[model samples]
Target: MHKPNQTKQATARGRGAGYNPDIRFDRVSRASFDDGWDMVEDLPVLRTQVREESAKTIISTNRSPDLSFDQSINPYRGCEHGCIYCFARPSHAFLGLSPGLDFETQLTVKPNAAMLLEKALRNPRYTPKTIAIGTNTDPYQPIEKTREIMREILGVLSDFNHPLAIVTKGTLIGRDIDLLAPMAAKGLLRVGISVTTLDPEVSRKLEPRVPNPAARLRVIRALSDAGIPVRVMISPVIPALTDHEVEAIVAAAKDAGAVAASSILLRLPREVAPLFRDWLATHYPDRAARIMNRVRELHGGKDYDPTFGKRMTGQGVWAELQHQRFKQASARYGLDRRLPPLRTDLFAVPPQAGDQMALF
Candidate 1:
């Protein structure tokens, strides 16, 4: 693990975090101080570093009750979409990296994901269920354009006739409509496009590397037009900032042909809390206090509450109000209908090149 020097605090271009936070598990810590030499201007440009990860297994099963899917596949670790409010940021600390800038700039790719997934699905004892992708990190992030690891994984699932769903903020998913449309026609694929805010300026500052809100809507339209079911996810609705756009976002997604809509309140867990706070201070200092105050109110007067049921949708007056607003907007736009369940009975492992031929 190569640890980068984090002694300087300067805003990196096209990055959300202005500085790296200390890795929580490290015994030793470092801090920045002025040496009276005015060295901040000498810092180098932050570039994304990619590392290949050879994973032993591809499918990860989680027992969290609040989650809709028990199994998920993350094609990559750490995300390039530097959304400061990401809950997945803390996961990077386990890789011996800071959850701040490092979480976005340093990425780990899983090249063997497709191979491992095929092996998992071929097991005789394996039972078919909906396997979700992009639950923790965006599978179709900027790197996916070239890596195409996600495309390979989808290929394996398609060959097996496995049911799968995807949640993403990237427009690259549109490129795979050929693969997705066929699966969707067989009732094996659905997509959730997360749109945090409709405001382009706010979106740029919040999710520095993500596709603009309008572009995301275009992706939803493209996917829907291909006969693929699309769900618009209004995730991490930032209070006092983008929270007011919930109705508008749902309406826009519905107009773009999304069949369903969902929303999650802003979550600031572990290292993400401070990083998001720093972002607020830098970008919207005037309303930073008000925004954080509302977040605390939503989370039982704390930065965050990890309680499963209360985590996704907060537990306060404002949280309830936000939920009500989303429900009303969804109903108004006819985006409240649940997508039909994907077929698990259709799951069948295709014969490999060397497999024994069946004879009657």
Candidate 2:
């Protein structure tokens, strides 16, 4: 069992987690301290370090009842967006890394994701289903600009006519409109863009590196114009913090041409709990206690509840009210209608370069 240290580091500029928590699986723990001499001001800005990962497989499958799709692909191991409330942060711990600042600064990318995906799809016993992208970490995180791993994966999926659903907060998805638009026409693609808070200040402190609310709205509009079904995600609806913006966010997304809306209540599982608490202490001290209290209330006096059906929605009066608010807002904005599911029947492996021609 590992216990997190209570000491917090000064918030790094343009970064979300203020300090790195002890790796949950490590036998040793470490902490930072100042002795007489002060060098805090001389500390260097945290720079992102990326490593190339040679993945044997690209597609991941899960049997969680809370998820809509079982098959998913995560092109990257860690997200660079640095969203403080991100539920995927804890995944970094499995790599023997902290789920705090390391979750954002240290990233591992799958350069051969497209090749592996193609290989997987070409397997004789494989079955076609909707493969979800960005469910664990944002595939279009900042590094994707140069890595283009997500783009390559998208290209392979399009070539195979594979059905896919993407969830992201990155604005770079707009760059792939050419591929996405054609796939949308074939009922092969849909996207969900998360807009946590409309307030730019809150967004800056909360998400840090993601595009602002307006830019994400524009992404929804652009995708919608391309005939791609867009869903606005009001994810991790923080109780005392961004919860007040639920209706406003839904309305704004609807105006931006989002065909549907969905939300996930804030989750503080594992190492994420302390990191988020530190974030709240640093940014919103006045409301931090109130926010955490509400979160605990929803989770039945705990930081989080991992129960299959209840994890995504939460429980208690506040959770019920939050659900009602989102339900009514979605209904009012005409975002209650669900988008048509991606078609798996269109999936077919295209001929390769040296393949023999088929008989007529």
Strongest candidate by lDDT: 1
- Kindly list the per-residue Cα lDDT of model 1 for residues 206-290, writing each as its tens digit: 9999999999999999999999999999998999999999999998998899999999999999988988888888899999999
Tens-digit per-residue lDDT, 13-76, candidate 2: 7889888898889999886555567555555667899998888988898999888899999999
Model 2: how far residue 96 lies from native, Å:
1.3
Off by over 4 Å in 2: 1-11, 38-41
Could you tell me how far off, in angstroms, the CA of residue 194 lies in candidate 2 after the best superposition? 0.4
Backbone Cα, N, C clashes tallied per candidate: 0, 0
